[model samples]
Target: MGFGFVATQILAVSLPILLGWALNKLGIIGGDLDNRLSTLVLNVALPCSILASIDGAEALPDAGTLVLLMLATGVTYVIAIAVALVMAFLLRDTEDARVSYRFAIAFGNCGFIGLPVVGAILGAEAVLYAAIALIPANVILFAVGPLFFIDATADAGRPADRLRGVLASLKTPTLAASVAVLVLALAGVNRLGVAGQALGIVGQMATPLALLITGSSMAHYRPLEMLGNPRAYVAAAGRLLIVPLASLIAVNLFPLSPFLRAVIVLDGAMPVATLGALYCLKSGRDTKPMMQVTFLSVVFSVVTIPLVSLVL
Candidate 1:
């Protein structure tokens, strides 16, 4: 069953690459399709997806699930940070490389890849649990993640700047959607109603659009280059293997629901976040190692994710 689930996800992720390659070959790659698709996913589809998952629920998850989720999320981050520190210590040659390695290991592609895969395997309710898990992860990613890039020699900015960054990060559409859906669920909204049905119809597009964008972007890179980087290989091992194993242990200790446990483990097992390399680029840092790690981790997840599913 695990292998079957992994196979389905791999096929979903790969078909778009072929489509992207065909688009490139036919000179149809010059349009703003990437941006358009991205906007649709982030703004329209993802929010609807979240809402559709929760809008019909009689109530939010029990307090126990919420508490366990918070604890498990914290443990996941701690494990990620610990693994990253170990990697940095072992591979310490340059500050930039250290930062990139740590960042890549600490953040996985939970939103783009994890959501669809978990939704397919564990069902839509599992996806909702994953979204709840994402709140803290995103907070750490956008808030504390930038601090990793700041050099000790650089002047730390004012408190206002840090507060602003944190606030800005929390303003993401998906997060807003999560909050809204939870609110509606608590308020007992009927998801089978006209509004709910409309959202569900639009929400169905999120998974495909996300996978297609990932596949299309991947087509432009050379697999050989990604595979050859030693640092990237190290990061990939940590991201795909060590972190997931640790997350599995941590989640198991908490007595979460079976679906929640599966969601946490699978999300933890995912490849490097697609945006990690982009963040590196925007920060004027060396993006090669980050890109290599991202590509290699993703390439290898087809195997690792399935293995993780078996454990769950």
Candidate 2:
């Protein structure tokens, strides 16, 4: 069952790439479309997706399970960060390459890819647990993730700089949605009525639109060139295999429920976040290697996720 769901989700992620490739070939959409789609996904679709999934959660885990899942999520990221730093030093020659590689390894597409896969395999309750993971993931991605690109010229004099960065990161639409949904759920706002229905409609667009945008961006790259990067392969291995294996060990050492354990393990096995490369671009670092790692990790996770699922 886990394998079947994973196979279907992989196909779902890939189909948009094919569509984007075809559209690009026909001169229908360009880079501008990619940006527009990303904005929509981040600001609208993703938040709705979070709200839709969490608000309608039928089975909430116990407080212990939630605490355990959070711990596993934090530890998985710490290990990933350590692995990324070591891999960056050993594998990459240039500072930019090292920064990009480290960022790719440290983050995963836990929201867009993860929520759907977990929901499919472990059901809606598990998605709620996965969202708990996303809260910290977003914080780390926005705040500490950029520090990878900090060069000698970076200004660390002001404490306000770090605070401002964190504040800006927390203001994202998805985070807003996550918090809103949590509030609504706590307040017993079960029947969102028109708002819920509307969010559900928009939220459904997050995954396909995200996949399409990712595919469209990929259309510009030469597959042979991207695949030839050794760093990409190492990062993919770390993201798909090593991180999840570490997560499995951490979860097992605790007495967490099977469902909680499964959620953490599967999340650990997710591909690098598509936005990591974009973040690298924003930080004036190399995006090529980051993109390479993200694309290849997704390709490899088609196998790794299923195997990890079976093991769990």
Candidate 3:
């Protein structure tokens, strides 16, 4: 069953990626089409999914599940940050590399990859669990990840400007969606049946659109750029393997719900997020490493994620 679930997830994700590649190669989808698809996924599809998931799962969560999630996530993040800091300090000697290291360590493509994969393995219930996991992950990605990059680049420019950059990023649809979901969830509005149903319909679009954007973007993937980069290899190991592996080992000592344990490990195993580039672009850091990290991490996650799932 685990193998079958993993196979389904790989197919679901890979199909859209192939479609995106085909579309882009055919010139039927390029330029503004990519941007529009991204906007649709980031702004509309994602927020709707969050609201819908919360609405669907709104009964006060099971105590065991909630505790399991908190422990798994908390342990994973703590270990990831520690390992990332050590890795960054080791790999980084230059200003740009240091900042890029921070982004590589902290951000994982949880939404675009994690949710769908988890949903495939564990079902929509697991997606809801994954969504809860993303709450903190996205916050760190948007709020903290860029700040590290900006600060790293501070020697080249004034440090204070990074504040404005962070503020500006607050307007992005993904961050805005995070806020919206949290607001609606806390207010108990998503629990209302009519509102919940509407949210579900919109939310359903997130996974498919996200996969398509991934596929399209990946269609243009540059293997030469990523294949031999030592930094890229390190980042991939950190995000797709080491960080998750460390978390899994720690999780073994705890008495958490099996589902939540599985979800957390799965989330940790996701590839480096594409948003790392957005952070680099916005913060005046080098984007090359971020791209490398993202590409390699995604490339290898096909093997890494299933391995994590199996052990869990």
Candidate 4:
């Protein structure tokens, strides 16, 4: 995409985020509505968006290319986890601090920020690649995600629980939708006719809805407090800067198309997943560390994501 196209796409995506923040601040939408809308976007709009992208695509990658994309994505995550482990040692103040660093750096806001931004800036075709990338990310997140925030020694975390999480991760709505769409596309079912039209209409909602939820979620966190954490700044640097740079080097080893290459770079460039904060809250862990990184990485990303686009 041209710089002009990227700029237009960023502005279009950024507007909903601003509006969502304003709406939450004014109490027009928050609490239950925000939660429900998040569910709607993740389960409905985002999946439909994935399907519609493939349905409308003029071309489809062969099964081998898709497998290669999955492996490339898996390698990216492995590199990220290794980076997180190394950084955790450098930041070893407390176990909690190490946990925060590892979690924040290793995973990204791929679904909420990466998906929409890629779709908007790179077109729907890129979103298909983004969807493919999500498979390995989610699998790793499930298999070992909680260990980042949950102490291995904690009594509350059982082996069975971890195994269940891994199994359940296999069934996430987004993953399910993505796999289903890929099968259909492979079977020459690209055009769903009227169903395709309906899906496209619903799919259009994913970007705006995901960003709105992101903005509204940000409203609940204290920006000044989030900004003041120097430790969080360290984590943000690893996430927003270090990880993307490392991902670029790692992805280059593969013979990927420029489109797949851009997807990996943009994926690495995204901010912390807002889901991480929610996970901390539900687990009764201190959410402050990740919330800070999430807030700062997000506020900084409007600039950084565009910068990463230049590399594409």
Candidate 5:
């Protein structure tokens, strides 16, 4: 059953990529569709799925295991980032490569990839736990992830200007929406039936749209350059395999609930967030490598995610 669930998510994620590629190849979808799909994903689908899965979830798991799992994740991410640093330095990679590698390890595709994978592996309730995990993940992304990229390039403006950029990043609509959904779920209000139903419909769209957008973005890549980048492969391996394997070992020994354990294990197994490309763009780094990392990470997760799921 668990393996089947993992397969469900793997298919859900992969279908859009394959479909988008096909549609583009057939001239049925254009570049503009990618932008629209991205907006639908971030603005509507993601929040709805979260709300639908978590709303009225009164049987929240014991904090002991969840807390331990969260801590384990944080520790694993820190370790992965350290490994990425060593890899970047050993290869004599550029500042952008270092930043991209670190960011890839630091940020996992929690919502875009994590929610559906958790849902399939452990049912909707696991996704509820995934929502809980997202709080800390957001903290790391909006606060810590930015710091790594910020220093990669020089600041041309005053200190105040730099501070403002950090502040602006904090106000991201996606983060704000995730927070809103979490707060409402905790309150147990459900926001009435129509609102919840509407949210669910939107949530269902997120995975497909995200896959499509990622696929479209991937259409811009150079295959030889992508294949030649060793950092991208290592980064994918660290994010999809090493971190999750370490988490699975810790989780098995930690006295955690099965559900929390599942969430933690899946969270660690997530692919690299495609948004890393945007971060690299903002930080004045070359985006081609980051895109390569994202594309490859998603591809490998087809095998890695199911392996992680079966272990959980």
Candidate 6:
């Protein structure tokens, strides 16, 4: 795909966010509607979207490539976590902002944004590799991802309490869907049937709804403030530029194919996952830093992603 295609896809993705913000500013959409949309996204749309992506066993790479992709993904997250840790140390502000920085640094918008970008720019085959990359990424995203937001510092006496919280959080529909996709694929179940088609249709709502919710969340804050603070900009720099550039250099040390390498780097280049804002909404945390960082990173990614792609 050309840079025009890249710009168009990003515009398509961004318009809803703008609309959501506009509607909220005009008082057309209210909190009740935002709550319902958030619930629909987290509980229903996101899970369906995930399952619908892997419609059959054929959607995955071959077993050998699958192992290689899994390993590459593992290494990718390892690098991501390392980067996030460094960021966490650097951006030591409020616990909330720190968590936002750490979470956004560690995960990118792979499933929601990267899949379509890769499919359009690379090819169908590369899209499949991208899909499989999400197996490990989502597992981490939904599994341990929330822990970043949770306060393990509260009580020194109860590690068990924290463990239980982590376990309970894992029961979310998104994580369940991830496990289901893996099991179904490994079992060689190759047909989603009419139900699958229905799921695929509903699953399409995930990204737009996520963007809208994020925008609505942002609307709660002042428009000028939503542009973000200096620390938030630092996080944006890491999300949009620093993290992906590191991945592009780091992944070359691995034995991955060129396509997988490109996918890994491009995945890293995606803007902050809207999932961060979703989690903030769910837990009633201040979505300030996340929303700010997400907004800046995504808008900058229009140029940043294309530049990174040129290198690839």
Give the candidate number with the greatest TM-score: 4
* Candidate 1 residue-wise lDDT at 169: 69
lDDT at residue 262 of model 2 (Cα atoms): 85
**Tens digits of per-residue lDDT for model 4, 1-312:** 667777777788788888899999999988999989988988999888887777767887888878888898888888888988998788765676677778888888888678989877887788877887787777887776776776566675567887877697678688887787768756766677888888889989888888888888889887788888787888888888888888888888898898888898897789987767767876777777878888888888887787788777
TM-score per model over all chains:
0.91, 0.88, 0.84, 0.95, 0.85, 0.79
Total clashing pairs for each candidate: 0, 0, 3, 0, 2, 0
lDDT of each: 0.77, 0.75, 0.72, 0.81, 0.70, 0.75
Which predicted model would earn the best lDDT? 4
> Which pairs clash in the backbone of model 3?
17-215, 48-203, 49-203
Error of 4 at 200 (Å): 1.0
Q: If both were scored by TM-score, which would come out higher, candidate 1 or candidate 6?
A: 1
TM-score ranking of the models: 4, 1, 2, 5, 3, 6
Model 4 collision count: 0
**Regions of model 3 farther than 4 Å from truth:** 55-68, 92-94, 151-191, 252-255
| Candidate 5 structure quality by residue, lDDT tens digits, 1-312 | 456666876777677877877777677765777777777776667767776775556564454645665676666566656666666566567777777887786678887667766776577777666766776676667667767777634654686876677677666455666566556554554544777777777677776677666666666666677778887898788778877777666667666677677777787688887668877887777877677777788778888888877776
